[model samples]
Target: TNIKKKMKPIKQTCFDKAILRHRSVIETVFDELKNLCQIEHTRHRSSANFVVNLLGGLVAYCLMPSKPKIPVAGTYL
Candidate 1:
């Protein structure tokens, strides 16, 4: 089902809630990668540099102490 700004009460089901939660988590990850990890850049000298920057940002993100995670089956890691 399509997500809407004005969601109707009857249309708010368990599946919809789960989908919305997952989307939010994905957005949060991208935001962190761009803002915290410094992945958003436009001054790359070459494709290799761009790849290196992206990899470095991802590695930095992996080393972060706290990360946004979606729970699986009501369990979090």
Candidate 2:
């Protein structure tokens, strides 16, 4: 079957592991913007209001302090 041909039991590379670890941060940012900021619900009567809100959100994101990245435990030799 074509599905069987595509199924290879290859080992996951380091890059794959890195992405799996870091992807959650990006998803959280999107969730926050949509839920907390009401960015998706913005409906302005004028162009100025639209621009101001969009720019304001972007500025807030840049100024926001990031959560500290916890250090991964090291294996002993």
Best by TM-score: 1
Residue-level lDDT tens digits of model 2 in 1-77: 12256698667788777656757765777776666555675569999998888777777666767632423565322
Candidate 1: deviation at residue 30, Å?
Answer: 0.4
Error of 2 at 68 (Å): 8.6
lDDT (10s digit) by residue, model 1, range 3-77: 567976465789777877699888999999999999997887899999999999999999999998889998996
| Colliding residue pairs in candidate 1 | none
Candidate with best lDDT: 1
lDDT of the structure predicted as candidate 1: 0.88
Could you tell me how far off, in angstroms, the CA of residue 38 lies in candidate 2 after the best superposition?
A: 4.7
* Candidate 1: residue 35 Cα off by (Å): 0.3
